[model samples]
Target: MPGPAPRVVFLGLDGATEAVLRPAFERGWMPNLEALWDRSATGTLWSSEPMVTPVAWTSFLTGCNPPTHGIHEFHAIDPAARTIIPNHAGRIRVPTLWDAISESGREVVSLGLPMTYPPPDVRGIVVAGSDAPGLQWAFAQCPEFGEEIFRDLPGYSHKVLWKRRPRTLDELRSVSLRNREVFRAQAGAAERADARCDWSAMMVHFHNLDGIQHRLWPYLDLDETAAHQPEWTAEVVACLRELDEAVGRLLELASRRDAAVIALSDHGFGPCRALVDVNGLLCRAGLQRRLPYGTRLSYRLSRIRDRFDRWKRRRSPEGTSRRGPRSIEGEVGCDWSRTAAFAPFGQLCGSIFLNEDLVSGSSAAGRTIGEIIDALRAAEDPDTGLPLFADAFDVAERYNLDPAAEGLPDVLAPSTDGYQAMAKWAPFSRSLLRPDPNLPATHRYDGVIAIDAPGVSPDTRLDAELPDVAPTALALLGQAVPEFMEGRILDEAFDRDEASIGTAATGGPGIRPARRPIG
Candidate 1:
């Protein structure tokens, strides 16, 4: 019979865009990636609706839409508790690609993939990434493996602190250098583990490119004023060059194993100029309530004090100190008792949730939702006079959402391609839209995907949605594409004879609804 099916190596580059990669490859900074692109089927990969990390990566992993996967954003709001919880791997309702592969008795190795914290019970090793509770305990399958791997490669961290701004070039250098080390270490661990383990599929995700893009986009595409800062620009280029080196190393490992290699990004990236506080708009419309004067005053003072502390630290020789992300929801002064509807902070997609209890006895829920939708659609950027929200969806009606789905937002407000919905609730003194200080670069919908394998055509254009990655990977391994997966195999990438082979496994019992109680 045929020798063991060719192994698959998937490299996930978070927030990579053709806009950036094309130019980088053309400049020869990424020679290995350019070589792969020349020989592979490549094209833009469509992302999830919101195009955020958790949602888009989950879709890529599950081969299903957000409605089917049940992960909408980074944080899910509990209507009853009036609190938001971090979204993690446990939030995924459907079986993942690794789960299916492992079920077929294939050993899998997954490293540094987002939303994989509290890692699933897979047949092989899993070291969680961004959403893990703590860096020390990010691994699930073998807890001690994390420490062992880090011992072999010191200075390994799953995440870099980005909430605070770097005050000096040295601070920025430190951040970028640490990030590079972590990424290289993670890839090194994956290479060593794959060599030692009995594995059919291995995936390694690198977030450094995305982090650098977010923090240094302005420097990367410098204006005359920013061009004066040569150090910043040079540092950004160095980080990118290091990223190319890491990609080259991974490709080398894949080739050594004779494995098919696929490289993809969850979403693209672009500069973000303004912030649109959706909750502030709702409060202005009387859809949400503001806190009492005294409470509001106290909150404002606390914010001032915090800013002062940050300022003091920046002035010190230590430069900027790393701080955990402060909750935007806590800054919102909404009075839930009188609130009919509110959008929580911290997502590009502005999701509005209705207080079901407050509206329980009223028949005006539909009318209220309609009014909110109209208001959001009418919202315009005062600076450019363009509409803030491109489209609004009643999630239940649009996505065929089950009424019982937990933490389901009643409305989803999607911004235009270049814009992002701001979740802060504080009132704007001048214009409703203002510059986003923390994040200069944000996500875009069209990410990049390139596939290279034995029968795949060279430089052929492949039209693929984000969900198709799972089925395509499974098909490449000669495994059946699960019937439950909404995505189809990307047959166009393969030769006519190779494409004709059967590769659909009957889906096991259809998707099971999440058991978590719906508010």
Candidate 2:
């Protein structure tokens, strides 16, 4: 009989961009990853539309487009109830890579992967990702491992670690230090768990890359030479050094298991200058209605009650772990009765729901999706005479989305470069557009993908996108690629004389829609 099937290890580096990676590699901050890149088949891995965490990572997990996966934003909006529930693992509609791998009678492991909260009961261990409410009891599908993971891994915590970005070198140092420890903790968790489990496939996600960049992009931007403060730059260097060591450790594990190693990112990252409030644009266009003072005050009171309820629950013995569907509605202060359209979710990329047409519309306010799209596309800045949006399209038409899919958007209108789009205005913002105080970093379309295995070519280019990861990973493991997968097997990446072997190449790699000329 043939030897055991080949193993595969998928490493997810969230929000990694070449802008940072090339510099880090050159600076010797991430020497391990640099060494791996020297012999790997690498190229840009473009992210899903919107290029946000929940959408892109979910695509990587499901091997499907955002519409197919039914995860377009960080929250799922209920049109009828007017509530916004946090998006979690339960929101994924299709079979994940883990689902396919486990179904093929192989063990797998998923660590620190976002959008994986409310862990799936698969054939192997699944330590929930950053999206989990808290790590206490909801950290893993196997409850036994949760406490051990928390105890063994030092400084382990989920996303949302800070209220604002660091303003000074000292503040940046504080954030960067914690980030390095968390990186070490996650790497430690994966290492410790691998010692106990028998697995053919594993995916470990390092979230610190994105968090640090989002909070400290300017100091790290390869461009802008004068902005690189020596002291502040050292903090970023320390964090990346930990990442390099973590990469080396995981690579060693892969070598021992004789596994094909693949490292990829959910999305790219860059500095953001302005904030584009999509709802403010809608309100100015007379499509959405802000609530009256009385109603607005009532919503504020409800918010206070919600916070109190959360505080009270934390004090109780039940703890923060709750295994159930998300119940809180979105806090979008809109008058549903008169609202024709509203952008209740999406960050960096705004998702618009045209009242009943997208599930949350009021019949009294009649509007066609086309009319709204035209209005958004027509929005311009008064001072600069520039368009607010890069592009606004009816999502159903663009992605060929399923008409029956719930929690999907009617339209996707992202801000142009130098601006981060939001569904609603900040509480005290006076205008639709304003400079970002936090200097927030936002996602870009070009991420990265690199594959290393015996048969694969060394340093060969392999340009692909988010959806390609799943089927390719399945193929690499000597498992059958499912028929539903839209991405190709990357047959070109492998050596000849074995073309279309166990894993057949379906078609060409997926390409995002071409970009239009910017203003």
In terms of lDDT, which candidate is strongest? Answer: 1
TM-score of each: 0.87, 0.88
Predictions in order: lDDT = 0.74, 0.73
User: Model 2 over residues 1-519: C-alpha lDDT tens digits?
Assistant: 022228888888888888889988988888889988888888899887777888888888887877677788887666455466678888798888888878878788888788777787678888777777677544658666667776677576665454577877788778777877777777777777788688888888887678777777766757652265778777778888998888888999888889888899988877676678888887878787787656676557666766666677667786553332222223567777777777766787778776674334433322456767888789777777777677888776777653325766777787665567887566545598877757567777789988887667765687787887777777666666666666656655666554442333223332223221122
Model 1 Cα lDDT, one tens digit per residue, 1-519:
121237888888888888788877876667877888888889989888778888899999998988889998887766455456567888899999999999999889888888787788888888887776556657656766776786788866677445445668999888778776776786788877786678888888887778777767777653321435668877777777777777788889888889889899998888776777788778778888777656566547656655676677667764542222333345565666788887765567778877675766435777777878988988887777888776777777777764325777788887766567877645534345767666777787889999887777775787678888887788778777776777766666766555332332223321222222122
For candidate 2, report its TM-score: 0.88
In candidate 2, stretches whose alpha carbon ends up further than 4 angstroms from where it belongs are 1-5, 160-163, 291-295, 312-318, 321-330, 335-338, 357-367, 380-387, 396-405, 497-519
Q: Deviation in angstroms for 21 in model 1?
A: 0.4
Question: Weakest 10 consecutive residues, lDDT, candidate 2?
Answer: 510-519
